[model samples]
Target: MKQIFAFMPTFLLSVIFCNAQKLTATDVNSPEVTVVVDIKVNPQFKSEVKSLVPELSALTIKEAGALSYNYYLSPDGNKILIIEQYKSLSAFQEHGKNLFSGPLGQKFRSSFTVNSIVVAGGNLPDSVGNFTVMKSIGGFNSKCE
Candidate 1:
C-alpha cells in the first residue's frame, strides 16, 4: 500500500504527459483562429448569465466556420472564461458581429462586464476592439472522436 501511494503521483503525471498532443507543422500553418475572453458576471445577474450560455453555445456552433465554442465559470460563479475557435479570421469576425448585435447579445451584455480578451492564431482587424494578440508558439489539439 505504501509503495502504491509513493508511485501514484508519478504514475498520474506520466499518464497525463503521454496523452498530451503537440501541434504539427500543418496545424501551425492552418488559418485557424482562437480567442479567449474573460468576463466578470454582475452579482445580481449570475443566474441570467448561466441560463444564456446554452443558447449562446448552440447558436455559435451552428456557424459554418465555428470550430468550437465553450465557456468556463470560476468556482465562485462570478467569473467566466470563453474560448472560441474559428476556421479563419473572417469567420471569427462574422461571429463577433452577430454576437454584439442580436437580442441574445443584448442579454449577454447586461449580464457581464468584459475584463479582457486574448486572440491567437491569426491577425485581427482593429474594428474587433481592444485585445491582446498572441502568436502560437507551441500547442496541441486533439480531434473529436
Candidate 2:
C-alpha cells in the first residue's frame, strides 16, 4: 500500500485523501472510523495556518494505517475543517498522539480553538457535549474497491 502511494504526486494524494471522507463501510472497521474536527481561527493567523496545511496533510496520509487526513478553510476563512478517516480506532489514536505531540499539534493548540469534534462508526464515546455521531449505512468509492 505504501508503495502504491509512493509513486503518486503529492497533490494527487491530497485529492484522494480529501475525497475518501465521504465514503463508508457496511460495518464498523470495514469502512473504518472517521473524525470531523472543526477548528476556529481568527483572521490574523489564517495564512500561517493555511501555509502549514499541505505539509501537515502530506505527512499524515503517509503514515501507516492512515486512510485520510485533510484540512479545509471555511467560506469566511475563519474556520478550519479537518476531515480524518482511519482504518481502525487504533489507527485514529495513533494519529491523535502524533497530532498532539508533533509540531502541527503544538501550532494548533497555540493558534486555534477547537469548535467541535464529531465521531462516526460507533467506535467510542458517542455524544459528549457538542459531538455528533454517525453510523455508516452503505456507500461505495471506486478508489476503495
Candidate 3:
C-alpha cells in the first residue's frame, strides 16, 4: 500500500542510525583479540588435516584465556579457515608460542600451507611476521550466553 511505502524509508533510516551508534560506541581499547587463519590443505594430507582438526581444536579450546577456537572447511574441503578469539593479547601470544613449538605443530605444518593470517582488535605488542593486522576503529562483538 502507499501508506506502507511512505513509512518504509523512515523505518530504514532509524535502523541505520541505531547501527551507526553501536559502531561508534565500540571500545577500541578493548583487550580482546581475534585471529583468522586461512590455509590450504595439501592434497596428499587431506585426510590427515581432517583428523587433526578435532584434536587441535580440543587442545586450543582448553588453553588458558582462550575464548573460542573454531574451524570452517570449504565445500571442496581443500581450504580451511580458523577463527580464534582470546581474552587478551597476551593470551594470543602464548597460544602462538605453544602452537609453533611441539610435535603437534610439526604435524600441522606438514598438513597445510598457511595462505594468510589476519588479526583484529587490540594493540599488537610486536610484529605478527607475515600476518595482516587490522585495528578496530568502530565495531562491536556480541557476547553469546
Candidate 4:
C-alpha cells in the first residue's frame, strides 16, 4: 500500500507534465482567438433580430477561413449565441472590417443594442443539459415531404 501511494504522486505529476506540454503545442498551432459571442437582445428587438437572421447567415458564410459558424436564439428569445471559429487572427480582423462596411452588415447592425452583448459563458444559464428543447420537438411538420 505504501509503495502504491508513493508511486501515485509521481504518476499523477508525470501525467500533468505531459498534458501541459501538449497544451503548449496546441497554443502554438491554434488561432489567436476563438470568439464566442453571447448577444443579449432587448425584448423589444427580438423580432427585429429574427428578421435579420438571413442576412447574418449570409455574412458569416461569406467569411474566408471561417471554421464553424453557429447562431442560436435563447429559449426565452432574449439572447443569442454566436459561435464563430477562424483559422487565424487575420481572418477575424478581415471579418470585422467587412462586417460593418457592407449594406447587409449595416442593416443587420441597425437592429441591436450592441452594449447589451456579453461573452458566451458569462452570466449565462447552466450548460449541463440541452439548452434548446426544440431539437427534441422537431420534425413534427413535413416540410421536406
Every candidate's CA RMSD: 5.8, 8.5, 8.1, 17.7
* Clash totals in order: 0, 0, 0, 0
Model 4 poorest 10 in a row by lDDT? 133-142
User: For model 1, which pairs clash?
Assistant: none
Largest lDDT belongs to which candidate? 3
Q: Write the per-residue lDDT of candidate 4 for residues 29-91, one digit (tens) a residue.
A: 333335566666766667777778777777877877776677788778877777766666566
**Best candidate per TM-score, number?**
3
- Give the per-residue lDDT digits (tens) of candidate 2, residues 37-132: 998886667778877787678768777978878788877888888899887767877877887887888777877888888778744554534567
Q: How many clashes in candidate 4?
A: 0
Alpha carbon lDDT of each predicted model: 0.81, 0.74, 0.82, 0.57
lDDT, candidate 1, 61-84, per-residue tens: 878999999999998999999999
Instruction: Give candidate 2 misplaced runs (Cα > 4 Å).
Output: 1-25, 28-31, 122-132, 137-145
- Cα lDDT of model 3 by residue, 73-139, tens digit: 9979899999999988788888888887878888889999999998888566446667788888776
The order by descending lDDT is 3, 1, 2, 4
Model 2: weakest 10-residue lDDT segment is: 136-145
RMSD from true fold, candidate 4: 17.7
